[model samples]
Target: MIEMKEVHLIAKLADLQEVDYHNTLVLHALIELLVEKGLLTHEELTAKAHALDSQLSFQLDLASKLSETIQNRHTQIKPIS
Candidate 1:
């Protein structure tokens, strides 16, 4: 038998999936419109996306390293009396 917690989790997952589907549809429509209007070509969009992805990845890595350093510093700190 499924537990109540399991049921709630399943419901949350379904909601997230629905939201993701709608967001994907909207993004696709916007991309198509931009391409159709000649505002941007597919190649340009792809290149920009790749550039942004790389930048974001670098930023995330830096953030993770900073977080780890903070954690280590906290562990090394002695509590003041």
Candidate 2:
């Protein structure tokens, strides 16, 4: 069972995901407009997309590592019997 403190964290994560989804839609519309106007090329968009993907990948890996470390540290601490 998730503890009360962890429940808030989970909720916050959900909220962030919701916000990101909305932002992504807005960005897609802007990108479409830019492409239609000749302000940006498809190649430029693809390169930017690749760069964002790499950044997100790195951040997720780092978050996973941090979470693992925190869990390990939590397990190592002896509880008062």
Candidate 3:
């Protein structure tokens, strides 16, 4: 069900994730432009990024706990004859 455009966008985002300091400077410039246009505030951008980091951390911790519980439960299962 994935469209070509969506796949391309995902690839572009992945590339962006791997960007180095120079690319970060370019992105910072774009962020500044957006701020200048009143499209987004610096505080709002940073706040959302922090919130996302916190949310992902919680999800990762929960996933680790769940994985451990699943492994322990699996070990307790009896094989069928």
Candidate 4:
């Protein structure tokens, strides 16, 4: 396993709290291990991460639009037929 010392340092520099800093170290270490073990090639990991990011961004955009629609719905004044 790659030494997580550098990752921890990075988390600290990024101003993550203690738990988050340590969790970042752990996450990096696990990813490194996965890459080293061939379970996830670097390219595969990169692609997967990018895909997830894109999906998450899309979900957030959809959620924002839905929320706006719902918020606006309450303000609509329907005319009597």
Q: Name the runs in model 1 displaced over 4 angstroms.
A: none
State residue 5's C-alpha deviation in candidate 3, in Å: 35
lDDT of 4 by residue, 1-81 (tens): 657998888878777577787999999999999988888888888999999999999999999999999889977967779
Model 4 stretches astray by more than 4 angstroms:
1-16, 77-81
The parts of candidate 3 lying over 4 Å away from their true place are 1-23, 78-81
Evaluate model 1: give its TM-score.
0.93
Residue 37 CA displacement from its true place in model 2, Å: 1.1
TM-score quality measure for candidate 2: 0.60
* Model 1 worst lDDT window (10 residues): 71-80
Candidate that would win on lDDT: 1
The candidate with the higher lDDT, 1 or 3, is: 1
The candidates, ranked best first by TM-score, are 1, 4, 2, 3
Which 10 consecutive residues of model 4 have the lowest summed lDDT?
A: 10-19
In model 2, where do residues sit more than 4 Å from their true spots? 1-30
Model 3 over residues 1-81: C-alpha lDDT tens digits?
Answer: 999999999999888777866688999999999999999999999999999999999999999999999999999999999
Task: Point to the candidate with the largest TM-score.
Answer: 1
Question: How does model 4 fare in lDDT?
Answer: 0.89
TM-score of each: 0.93, 0.60, 0.59, 0.70
Q: Candidate order by lDDT, highest to lowest?
A: 1, 2, 3, 4
